[model samples]
Target: MAQDAKTLDLIAIGRSSVDLYGQQVGGRLEDMSSFAKYLGGSPTNTAAGGARLGLKTGLLTRVGADHMGRFIREQLEREGVNVAGVLSDPDRLTALVILGIRDRVNFPLIFYRENCADMALQPSDVDETWFAQAGAVLINGTHLSQPNVYETSLKAARAVKAAGGRVAFDIDYRPVLWGLTGKDAGENRFVENQDVTAKLQEVVALCDLIVGTEEEIHILGGTTDTIAALRAIRKGAPDALLVCKRGPDGCVAFPDAIPDTLDEGVSARGFKVEVFNVLGAGDAFMAGFLRGWLRNETVETCCEWGNACGAIVVSRHGCTPAMPTWVELEAFLSERERPFRLREDVELEHIHWASTRDRVYDELTVLAVDHRSQFLDLIAETGGDPERIPHFKTLALRAVRQVAGRDEARFGMLLDGRFGLDALAQAADHDYWIARPIELPKSRPLEFESSADVATELTEWPAGQVVKCLCFYHPDDEIALRERQERQLLRLFDACRKTRHELLLELILPAGMDSDSRTVARAIRRLYSLGIRPDWWKLEPLQDAVAWRETEMAINENDPLCRGVVLLGLSAPEAELLASFEVVAPFPIVKGFAVGRTIFYDVARDWLAGRIDDEAAVAALASKFKVLVDAWRRLRGAAEKAA
Candidate 1:
């Protein structure tokens, strides 16, 4: 009678723990400088991965009343995984695993799961009614190794089976967790034991699908021979889908069932990727497999999906956090470039992490004064002397604070390094999100910072800051010109990676090249093909909702993880700029606006002309900035109300 109003694609029951990975690569765990915490554990990762792949997934596990436990729950919920069945254990603490990447193949891990909250899962925690609310239920091998949790898993499996739900067993057999190996047993690929084999076989007999590595299968089948193992597994569960994961070679699936003498099975080749970490590949594979199986896809397609997911997870670090989204996977599949491009090893990682970071743009209003050359010329004209430009930087920063003026609105600014590093630092000190420009204007071809090589200059810049770089881009530009510009942008993208700075690529289609929103969208796609995935795209405002939609589709198709678009005010009048906001209002992809002259031009001119003092200029600039901010907010408010 375990039925709920809502049903899920898959419900996974077992271990959920926190993985604290050492950040310093190629170093021993003890020598690593820092650790990055991510939600981990086999069942938890599978649930999170399923949700990432667009499955309605849920987790049934127990975590301690601690910070790590809270983090695990929150992260699962954030990924759209239902955690209604994830219970809290007040007595025991959450399990923890510390992992270190010594090399592509060497990942040293230490599991601290002795008497953990997940192990404290009792039979009472099993909600039999919930079994009716899932198409499939998955129970891990490690969960069956422990008595209390084993009983809990058994009850859940029985209830699921009784409710006509398919049960999938993942042989997540960890030797160390089973107390069959020492702490130094770097990889627990297999552990041969009579008791363990019997227990696993008991559950394997009940599963509609059985997934494990060769070693796991050998143990479950109670033999070292692969054929013998297949026969034994088939004897236990003749209708179970048997999948044997063959590492980088991909996997083979006996879709209907394994036979006594299996000669062939549906197979898929794995994607070739430079492995960064190999910890979460299996769980990621299972997630993909489930997504395909539940959709009733061909066994070969399911294996292909599984391999693709594993490839992505291994190319990055950590477990649940490293699992790719549907959009990311599609992009990864469609684009096939060499594993290593110039500076790709470093840049791709940064791009992956930056794009995956949660970007919530709920009425974000950004003030951009990151103008250069032609835009700066007007500032010089207003100020009467180009030499007074440095002072304008200070004025701009002061005006930023004035505009925000104690309001708790999410505000951002795009400043340039030419005369604005100090202002950048100031804005950062006040904790305002700031973006600094790296592009030098009007060079023979799009030039980056001139003072030093791209890498050297970026190294000196402050860490954790957003960099803004512009290019005079047009899709129809001569091939040579386009290539040159793209090369320069790639260098800038690499520089951003080395500096650990987020990039906001400001793209301007030269005054007229049959330009429309579609042209701009094409330019964005072209950059993505060249592997320039920026954190934000600063685009000129399009005229209508249709154009905006086209541009958004391009961004999604090219770089699904792109940090959305922001309208750039090209020194337009305030009224005209506000009009642009109205046009962009219907498009959620246009997160906010980064308008320079519209907000600060008049105030700068009045102040430089000796009409208004510094204080008065600050007030006027703040007022103008606030006016635009209020206007943008009003549009957003109206849109929300309409929706």
Candidate 2:
């Protein structure tokens, strides 16, 4: 079956089992004294954290088909976990872990997981369909210690990435699991314990993110101090975020440096909560980190959430039972704004490809409309190798047009009007096309005679069911006087009432003038009065906005409607900084812009007028467009990710 749409934001890929926790009532070890049985596992807890944080979460793990398995699945289900890919096998009872707390430390004992349900997990058990729907996939490092489970997890992680998802590896180092406790510290982990540091060391490099406790870090690095161990872990996951959970002292964070202006520091203990038990503290921290990481929170803030969630988990008795819900985390962060502000964004890596000289031409030929095709063929005849010519910039122009055609299905209609009543319906219910608007040199469309009584007709005008809308205003000309703009807004409001369809408005700010406080104030007032919201407002392009951070700030302050603004076609460092802003975010920015030259009006109308006959060329064009979209979307505001 296909993955559910309410698919989990975080998917834990590992063992799902039963954990029995018993505490010492005075000093005797009793299996039944205040014993608590709960569904527990590293991957399970991570999934729980994501679900509690209001994220659709799921789990893909192995568990016995007996009562223990049933119990684990039921427990996860209660936490809003999707169990579609949660495999159940009758071979072994669900893995069982018994933990006896002594002096605030955990001494956990486990039944062998060899050939067990979770350990029995095979590469055939999961697919890209499951991974593609998840925002992040968590893999247990301990599981990687075993050949079967370890190899299985590596395959799963690769599948997750192949499906366009992020992966987080939890280094839940269980020395006992590896039987390294009695062996000499210098002995090989694999030879002495059947599990080796060498294998784990290699797996460490494969993970996109790593989580480790101070002691685990010591075991991996053979260091006495946590900081030194952290440095060692950093070497393995230099590109991945290294999340180290300090026992009592608050967490430290490291967000990528964006040059000047960004002030980085370790987080302070935001809350002093009562401690209940420490067994699940690290797991809780991991859950919080996953939640914060998924939300795109800044480094320090992600740790802050981690610390808060960990504190709460430790304050409770049973494992996975102490996890706070998404609402609770949001409230916790709201109370501590210093480094706990919740934020999030999607992440993607960049790669520069080296292919053939005419690669661009070959790729773009796929998007050729009739005119573009004929024009391209002429160009090929004139400049391109009739057989093997290397066309440069001029060929690049045709390539760009071809690129646009390939995205025809996803093309959105962008109007230069003040209100995009018609565009929104088309994107959501119709084709997933986008509609944007160019800032008109005038206040509204040139078609408008003046900002006169167009209000009455607009108010009575029928509503549009489109999903995207574009609004244009000349910021430079300062035309469309505030009064006129306000009236123009009333017309938009009327148009909205005419339709029940959802729509996103793309308002284009004038190029020469990136921001106008007064203009923004006028637009906001009009929008608020109409009860209409703008999902995205394209302020000057990213390339143009970076140098004008002050303008962005001022405009945002004045325009409440820019709350959901997305700066499109951004190409500036400041644009990215603004995207990562704790309060303001430039989300889903339009990139890989496909526009025609002003000289092409005669032929541009037919840009979508053809079926590019070359299948390979068409696929290449589509792929290139997709690449551009991802690159452009990276322009975002500040975020909160863990260290």
Candidate 3:
């Protein structure tokens, strides 16, 4: 394959596994109460990290035919990585690593890689055509520890090299994986062995770029001295770019000869940031370095990118998730004096949260069935049992499914756990854009539905489920009332941030509050002044284009990254709602609508009154929804043409 034919920027062929990190910091793995699962493995992290930094990356590894395997594949796909090379092995289970953050320097971990799926990767699994499609291939040292995997990785490297592609090696020296240390000592960085050194040298001879820590370099060079180790590897592959990661001191790159002093090489100073867990910093460094190197950037720039990535990761938890996006990386690099405590930098944290989101809704058409009180009222009015509300919600989702079918990416649902638990589960399983209600229905001061500790309550919910809080707030309310509402909203915003859930703040004017174009916009501004930035805002439609622009400006000035706004129905008739859609459709910030009663009230009431069967109710609901969807799309189309 020619270099011009290379579709992938990088292909990482090595270990990929699920890492369960202890949630409680400074606690022993044995005493940890909970563990948060994240994608792990050095090469895997690098692949994901590279993708997050705008690289078209692929992972050439095997995962078991299990839920964990699906998770690894899905997560890589979510990161925009090519998963065509992530094969499934039926015989072996996926690899797993249990890690705990004891402190900044002490991270305890245990690998459960007894004949894991990734280790079972065969040389035949290396698709030369696929490998040739990448500009570069990265192989980790752990894969070179075993005879079988070593040959497999070697085949991948040779394929890439043969096709006018470069090869990079990460001297990921793990002694436990090499059988040089006890099985439980996964945290041990290095254990010298002549066999390992010989194998590493063979890999080093085939690489165009090499990266590792000083201890890793020592292991590869068959000596305890860092300079001597570099000299030995340099003698074998003298033209290779050797990068030495020096932890917090940053990193040094030797493009030619090994220098007497490490500082004599082209070096980039690391950021001064507090360390949270340093487990995956080196992987992050490799990813950041590749982002520059693959672009034919200077070694100094590569070191700068690598050092900054490592610093950012060390200040946070997990590996792949801690990897900064291109926007976040640029923001950090653009800083004149980077903050030492990176976690406290609200702007950076917000940027990370906003930019790293997997889902991006260009136009969201949501069916809102999260009405608890309204459903109960309907059941009572129809003399029907409230126990059937769950089934009704499930059927409502079925109606949504009938219209959405799987190809339509714009469809979403706003469901409540009280009556829509089954529907929520189904929607989540299908990976729909779901928003679940958190606030108690019709609460004046915005009280939570079940638990006062909304943060803890959110832990039980799926990470992708957006927390939708409906606040009937008005800026001109009495100070006491306004303060109470703001206080609860602030608490909810903080909780959403902590749980890593997107918040959809639905703000409505109290029954009557001098209605005007700027009412909702002012309310949004008030929330912004209170420092509560939601990922999304759900508002009632404004009367005209000027009102819509005011709301858009408020959101844009407050948070340019806000996920845009969706119109709420407020049980308006279909004609009325369609007119409102036309008025707001021209605005760029108005992303479709989330209307419930307008689409489902009549149909659901008729079903409960025995005037219509399930099929009739579903058809009626789907027809109403399709009308609104078509209207929104038609107006949006016209607006686009006008623009």
> What is every candidate's alpha-carbon RMSD to the true fold?
7.0, 20.2, 1.1
Candidate 3 per-residue lDDT, tens place, 146-178, comes to 788999999999999999999999999899998
Instruction: Supply candidate 3's per-residue lDDT for 623.
Output: 88
TM-score of each: 0.71, 0.48, 0.99
Candidate order by lDDT, decreasing, is 3, 1, 2
User: Candidates ranked by TM-score, best first?
Assistant: 3, 1, 2
Tens digits of per-residue lDDT for model 2 on 1-643?
A: 1234425577788867787767443243444465557778777877876676677788888878788888788677767789887888977778877665544443444445546788777778877676777767888866875777777787877776776677887777766556555422211222223235456667666667777765565665446555665566667767777665666665655443212211233464645554446766777788887777877777777888788777666655666765766655555556443222121100000000001000111011111111223334544444533221111212323333454554434343333223222223223343223332222233354223323444333333223222333456544445455446545454553443322222345455545655544454454444554445443343433333342344444445443223233433322343343343322223222222322221222232232232232343334444554454444333221221211
Question: Which of the two, 1 or 3, has more lDDT?
Answer: 3
Runs off by more than 4 Å, candidate 2: 1-7, 106-114, 182-195, 256-265, 268-270, 331-643
In order, what lDDT does every prediction score? 0.80, 0.52, 0.91
The Cα error of candidate 1 at residue 454, in Å, is 9.1
Tens digits of per-residue lDDT for model 1, 1-643: 3334337888999989999998889998878777877899998999999888888999999999998889899788878899998788899999999999998778888888888999888899888887677888999998987889899888988888888778999988888878889987746678788788888888877898899988888988988888788778888898899998888788888866565543477797678777778899899999999989877888888999899888888877789987877766665666557463212444345445654554455556777777667446665676566666667667777877776767424677777777666677677656566777777765536887665578778767766467788788888999999889888888888778655678888888887578764777788777887888887888886666777788889888776556678888888888888888888887777788887877777776776677878788777777888888888889877876787
Pairs in steric clash, model 3: none
TM-score of 3: 0.99
- TM-score winner: 3
TM-score attained by model 1 = 0.71
